[model samples]
Target: MAANILLTRIDNRLVHGQVGVTWTKSLGANLILVANDDAAGDELQQKLMSTTADSSGAGIRFFTLEKTIKIISRAADRQHIFIVVKTPADARTLVEGGVPIKEINVGNMHFAQGKTEVTKKVYADAKDKDDLLALANSGVKIYIQDYPGDKQYPITDDLLSKVE
Candidate 1:
């Protein structure tokens, strides 16, 4: 049984103030799942993010990519889950692993050495572009939105081409 997935977001910062409070309340999600291998293994990150979610009155859990695939696939219908992953590649893995992600919010990719600016809040490197293109090809509706009230920019081929 698939869980009642409220939102699937790609934010490099994972669970932060905006996501833990604003998005949680807006979506009415009861649980926040941080699906990142690094956060899963780092107790400090887990603790910090857990604190953020707790403040928003949402249950929080950290899981590796594989574990996330397994758990989310079998999640109970009553579980209103909000999944947060760090990268487009991770989101692609979840979708390919049968997590039933239909649409994805590209929240924040952040600027990095090899990345090109896609939007004010989104930056993508070659690998990120490839992974995101793969997801789009697979029928995932990908868009960029920083907050709940922000404008959504759909990731089109024109947008991707402009990155280079």
Candidate 2:
């Protein structure tokens, strides 16, 4: 069986109870890659996330952004890999660094103190909108999805609306 990645998601609350109990199973995730520099550096957080990465021996990995970009660009697996990032900045970094991805799934971006819009499953602020737009123009599909199984709204949809 060729291992593949199911979804690359951005969620600050990485490996929370929902992830451990629900998302993993619902998505049939066999690997969870926590690609956040801070999270990977913190020993305690790493241990905690590891515990939640699952008891099923699904390979759990944590990589700094640079390393992750290299790894994802080269990876070819069929077993589902579920990546969790803490923020959109990380997403931007990966794309800007030229990681080969066509789309990104946004999941549960918590309300910060900026401009607001709860579009579908994501809470997007003004800056988030700007970033998403940039990625969209670059041909990346930025989407709103709280879980892997959730229905998605492609950023392209919004782009089309504005043009019309």
The model with the greatest lDDT is 1
Against the reference, the lDDT scores of all candidates come to: 0.90, 0.71
Q: Which candidate is the best by TM-score?
A: 1
lDDT of 1 at 22: 90
Q: Encode model 1's per-residue lDDT on 6-113: one tens digit a residue.
A: 889999999999999899888899999899999999999998898899888999989999998887767878788899999999999999998888889999999999
Lowest summed lDDT window (length 10), candidate 2? 155-164
Off by over 4 Å in 2: 1-3, 74-79, 156-164
CA shift of 95, model 2, Å:
2.0
- Which tens-of-lDDT digit does each residue in 1-164 have in candidate 2? 32355766778787776676477777788888888999888989988878877664566788999888876755666657777777777878877877665657777777566545556345666566666677777887677776556677777545333321
What TM value does model 2 have? 0.78
User: How far out, in Å, is residue 108 in model 1?
Assistant: 0.6
- Per-residue lDDT of 105 in model 1: 94
CA RMSD per model (angstroms) = 1.0, 3.9
